[model samples]
Target: MTTLVRGRGWARTHPLAVDAVLASAVLVCMVVGSFAEPNGEHGPTWGTRTPDAPSLVLMTLGALALVFRRRAPWSVLAATCAASIVELLTGQPRAPVVMCAVIALFTVAARTDRSTTWRIGLVTMTGLTGVAMLSGGPLPWYAQENLGIFAWTGMAAAAGDAVRSRRAFVDAIRERAERAERTREEEARRRVAEERLRIARDLHDVVAHHIALVNVQAGVAAHVMDKRPDQAKEALSHVRDASRSALNELRATVGLLRQTGDPEAPTEPAPGLHRLDELVDTFRNAGLPVEVALGQVGLDLAAAVDLAAFRIIQEALTNVQKHAGPAAKAEVSVVRVGPNVEVTVIDDGPGDDKGDEQRDVEQHTGGGHGLIGMRERVTALGGSCSAGPRYGGGFRVHAILPVTTAKGGTA
Candidate 1:
């Protein structure tokens, strides 16, 4: 089987050479058959008589025409048919030269459409058989030799048509398989891009929120280190706790990128609104006095909605701590309305106006700032989030998230 496959591959690469070899084989068959007498004592007798000079010449021309069958199927078929008809009319005993014509007809049928194959096939079969019969041979018009021409020509057309159909079917299947594989690869690439963006968002939210708190507490510790050691020690303790929490969250976020063969990571679920009290406590410890109001516990919300809600609140309060001036007080409210949960963070600190204008530009232009992240998280959940300066003073961030997301599941 392997050898046969290699031979077929080589034949495909060198088509004219393959046709030359096939023409040689058909010539040998015609020559050998011409030497056999149709009637004998037991069966047909071979070597009793040989093809005459005209018969041999016609056979050679017919076989030679087949060498270019694939290149010009119609021309080759016409040439072979002319040679066969001439030999049938002039030669005493027909030299089976029509075998080359049969092979040419098969090539035409396999290469051309069915309609052309049928039209040309009928013409070739009728023309050869009619000529063979019309020629004044010793045998009758309905002899097996004359009838064999009709039979072999018809069978060749049918067989070639079958080969053409099977080849078309195999080509179509291969094209569909290639298209499906490309679609799967494109889908994989799209999924990878989405995962990378989500991981970046998680990292930004985690780092921005905790680092801001650490910076604030470290500054407070340094300000009163000599004058008020007790207060400074408390501030340093808050800094240590913030750093540790940041490390743990960073590990969980980065672990998502680990391969299967790597060491096992912590299996804890992602943070969501369930950790709201804990999130509020972190900011309170950073010298930012925060007041919290909860209308209804949103612990039963969908996982994505819950996570979006938590991150929005975390980002809003962090912004208030970073952008809103010191001695600023913040109010955080989480209210579960019908079919939705509303989160609003309003700070009374006098926010810098120039910086707020720049943030507005960045937010509109798809910046990676905290407000942009907040809006992106909300938008991904099909919700709306707005952050801007309030009427009289500080900034406010508000987001209304759906209770059940498109791909909803409890956290």
Candidate 2:
């Protein structure tokens, strides 16, 4: 197989040399056959026993025409056929000159479509056979020479057509395999990108939610250090708790990216709507007044929708704590309306002109990626989220997630 591949590569790179070798082989065959006659001594006495100078010249021209067979198949066939016809008309005995025409005919069939092969093959077969049977010696119409020419030319055409068909089949299979490979590569890339985006969203939610609480508590500890030492110590303790929780959550999030075979990572389930109370308490301890209201809704929500809802609420309250000032109060509500579950987080903070300006500056400096991440998560799960300033004051974030019906109940 290796040798065959190398030979094909060499032939493609040095086509003229390959053609020269073929021309040499054909010249040798014709030269050797010129000295021999058909039917031994029992043949009818007709044309010259040996090839004359003209016959030799015709034979050489026909054989040499094959060197350009691949470059111009039809032209090569025409030249070889013309030389053979001249030999036939001049009463030359059966010789290997016809072999060159047969080779040329095969090249034409191999290179061209089946329709062209049929037309040219038929013309060459009929013309050469007719000439051999009628113009030459006193051989009969059914003579072996004429029949042999007919059979050889027909076989050449059929063989060449077969080669052409096989080549086309191989080429088509190769093309389809390449296309499939390319499609698989593109699909793999798309999956990797989606996985990276999901990890990014998870990291953002973990860091923003926990770090925001830590920041607020640390500020409280600093503000009360002189006047109220007891409250300052309490605040510092809350900051420690918040930081520990953040580290744990960050570890869990990072663990998700580890190899499946690794045994050191945590196996805890991801945070979802069930963790709403814990999430609310974290912000409450950070000194932001938070109220939670849960409506009648099934607990069997799909994991993805539940996680998205939880993250959206988490991010909204984080934004409130950051932008709504220390005097802000936040309200969170989860309710079921028809086939969807709605989550709303609203802050009754100062949304005055000065607050709006600061918020705008924060947003411009890349503080708004939390909202964008929330929207992306909701949209991915066939849900919708909207966030903006409220009518009178403060900001509100609302999201609705579809409850898909499952085998046992709605999910």
Listed in order, each prediction's TM-score against the native is 0.88, 0.88
lDDT string for model 2 (132-170, tens) is: 888757778887878988999999999999999999999
lDDT of candidate 1?
0.88
lDDT of 2: 0.85
**Clash list (residue pairs), candidate 2:** none
Model 1 per-residue lDDT at 26: 95
lDDT of 1 by residue, 1-411 (tens): 999999989999999999999999999999999999886778789889989999999999999999999999989998998998898899887799999999999998998788988998898899999999999478899988899999999999988888888889999999999999999999999999879888888999999999999999999999999999999999999999999999999999999989999988879899987798999999999978999898875457787888888898998898888877787899999898887789999999876776566555655675647777787778888789987778898777889987767566532
Worst 10 residues of 1 by lDDT: 359-368
- The predictions' CA RMSDs to the true structure, in order, are 2.8, 3.4
What value does the lDDT take at residue 176 in candidate 2?
99
What's the CA error at residue 284 for candidate 2, in Å? Answer: 1.0
Q: Per-residue lDDT for 126 in model 1?
A: 92
Look at candidate 2 and tell me the lDDT of residue 297.
65
In model 1, the Cα lDDT at residue 73 comes to 92
Q: Given candidate 1, what's the lDDT at residue 165?
A: 85
